[model samples]
Target chain A: MISTASAVIGSRVSVGHRMLALTWLISPLLLLATWALVAASGHYSAQLLIPPADVWHTFKDLLHSGELLEGAAFSLRRLASGFVLGASGGLLFGAALALSKTVEVYCAPMFHVLRQVPSIALIPMFILVFGVEETFKVLLVTKAVFFPVALATSEGIKAIPRSHFEVARLYRLPRYSLLLDVVFPAAAPPILTGLRVGLTRAWMVLVAAELLAADSGLGQMIEMGRQMMRIDVVMVGVITIGLIGFVLDSSLRLLERRLFRWKAIKE
Target chain B: MNASLDQRWLASTSHSPGALQIRELSKHYLLDGQPMEVLKGIDLRVKPGEFVSIVGASGCGKSSLLRLIAGLESDYSGDMQLDGKAITTTSLERGIVFQDHRLFPWKTVAQNIAIALKRSPLTRQEKALRVAEHIRLVNLQGFENAYPHQLSGGMAQRAAIARALITQPKLLLLDEPFGALDALTRISMQRELQRIWVQHRSTMIMVTHDVEEALYLGDRVIVMDARPGRIKYEIDVDLPHPRERHAPRLQELKEILLTELAGSDADK
Candidate 1:
């Protein structure tokens, strides 16, 4: 009986591991297969319905020519710089609003109203102000990253129980120690989630800004491919954009797990 | 060995250090824009190394009184003094344990206890040693690295107790510290707490709703009445430490206290 139980448990563990590994590949494989079958049916126009092989060939061509890498690097640099500026500002502003009643009362209404104005909606005004240049694209990305981060940070801070602060007071912990030991850890999970959402939003806005008006970038590359009627090139650009976004999101999730390992153990 | 080290350290410092004196202490709160009295004319004296247990029904202001004593609440009327000093704000000399344990969920047991020592003048090594000792004092040595969520309710409350006592507070205030535990765990914890009290001899005040608990561990059990809460009567157990749970005296006192508590309910 013991042997059978051990055998069952061992097999179950291996099955669980297999399922986890399969999850990462399942969706992409299914999508690829569906695309290939649709292209092979010849029911649609070939110009619009490029096969998986053609898209793969185009991806390789772009990689060998270094256009994809250059566009990706430029887009990433803009994303990094803009995300850093917007997220830092959002964190500080959100914490200030949470901590100071006066700041919250005075600025919260305005912040809420302004955050409702979507980043894409402000593109025309931003283009007019900063011109069709790096500034316009970076600013658009920053605006995209800012609101979600700020809202998340403020909400996270507010959600911390008053008991935590009371405990801090009981110990008479210094300001820095209270913040470091109590406030930050208590507020971190939500803030990290906000950062993740901000990062993805920033990437989407940056791509849209580039597609609308830019001399270079992955979005511009796709736009150029569309103008030139090279559907395969556009497909490659789309796939690359998706892959990069996935990588960025996954890296942030890894960081969240590392920092909040305690949360995982609880579950 | 570590226990003796802790005992020696505690002995070297002033023993039986805290003496709490309350003079007609009353507190009011704004309830829907109208002032509501919670505690009314509460006067009590606790000598150094005394264990006082307060029992009352819910909304009896027993918790508010404990909060006031811990200096977590400062808007109350009347005077409260600890060691001849006025109680205004929280001091390291007074530590509190709430019923819910209130351990920082993200921190391990060791980290939670060590964080309480942040404001202490002790060196880092001494703080670490003291944390280990207190963890041992609570009989939670192997669970040092466990998070609060990983602990059972009784274990988490034990960790909370260690955190409260880590600063060597002269006065330790517990507000329903064992109210959330199961009957079996609660009994065990009461015994554990009694053992610790006998060993350390700190001035401790615990507010509980359990008459048996108050009678079991307290040197003096004070019964309170609610609705503008005030002390109704006090019972001196006149018993020594490590008293038997099934003692005839305790059974007799429990019956008396239960009757008094029932009378208060009837009056309410």
Candidate 2:
């Protein structure tokens, strides 16, 4: 069996198992080097052209003052509440749409139309209805998460091969057992991918919503930095946001690999 | 070993391997509002512990016939029964393997085979033991943890066969179970299937386009014709288990079957 696997997925294990390659750092280093060169070249004013070192100093100050942690915690808390509720709701709704002809016929067109309207465009109405507080930000995040996750779940369930259901019937698997043993496993890959996509998109929307109006968040910190003319503080917020988003997405991708290791088996 | 439980399973399996009886079985489908007949008034009988093979050209509905027996479809008008029980919905007594090895991709080989026992009366320990036993039966001991895609085509098919049989079903249906294989793998799997049949002695019915495969494994071969499918010929192999592949008798029968099949093809 190992031989057969090796024959199909030859030598990829070596490349795939590494956590990080030295080559991955080169691009980031190059970007930083270019930024430093520009800062030293002295084209822009000191305010506009603060060096990477100044951003690092700002990063340290935020870290030491606990502002960064507080802001990050607040942002993440909102994401968690919104994502959990939205994703679970989407999962249930998507499953219903996939499993029931009634749901598909009645709800699919409206779902398609609603998902097309971007969450950012709904902010003014959302502000009026839900107010420019935590409710507004979380709802925007939930909206961002719901549509893609539901779409993915519905399509994923529909994509499961009919023959699998036949086999389930042949063995007379009970309804719940059929769902657990066959249906869920087949649809899991796509559903997980949808979650990753939703979470990242929600993060983007939540940040934008915070920038528009929020008491405390990473996005609000960036907004404050702009008002205070602290370019270094703005850079700190920007870098943290980018790094956090990358970490969230990368971690989910890793989780997907770990969960679906069997998928590596070639057909 | 649980001697009494093992004895019960053996007795239930060998003493009364299900007998399949079919009569006036015909199936049709509505193709864009037109009723298209796929099988026409077919009749077949499979005795207990019998290995029956059905062969036909495309559109012969040999597969549909097997699916009907497996109770995968119910729209057909017919008398179909296993051991005097009228077939209605899918039953655990009738297990099927398709041309594709339908081992769940997410499952390991052991897990795949074990799923067949989800509704079995066996205790968890007995189910595990039986799964291991079937793994051995299919010569897949070392591959038990391997996923389907990790297996070679032949290995995957053997795993599928193991899954089909682990239920201790009265009748196992194979719809071109080896049609996806290369020549070498096909021959080896046929030998493996024959050996398993000799050991388990459960009733099996296989459908294949390969006349040689049908003749090699089957105690009796039923040739079918296409376009409103009907059984055209039945040839009994008057041979024993572990029949020699290169035997003069098999070769002779193959010649006759091929000539009849060629004649039917010429008419097309």
Model 1 per-residue lDDT at B220: 99
Tens-place lDDT per residue, model 2, B100-219, is 999899999999999988888889888887888778778888998998878999999998988888767889899999999999999999999898788777899999999889999999
TM-score, predicted candidate 2 vs. hidden true structure: 0.92
Could you give the interface RMSD of each candidate, to one decimal? Answer: 1.3, 0.8
Instruction: Evaluate candidate 1 and give its CAPRI docking class based on DockQ.
Output: medium
lDDT of 1 by residue, A1-267 (tens): 999999999999999999998998999899999999999999988999999999999999999999999999999999998999889888888888887899999999999999999898999999999999889888888888888888888999899999999999999999898878988788899989999999999999899988999989999999999999999999999999999999999999999989987774632
Worst 10 residues of 1 chain A by lDDT: A258-267
Task: Tell me which residue pairs clash in candidate 1.
Answer: none
Task: In candidate 2, list every pair of residues with a backbone clash.
Answer: none
Give each prediction's DockQ, rounded to 2 decimals: 0.73, 0.72
Residue A11 lDDT in model 1?
A: 100
Among the numbered candidates, top lDDT falls to: 1
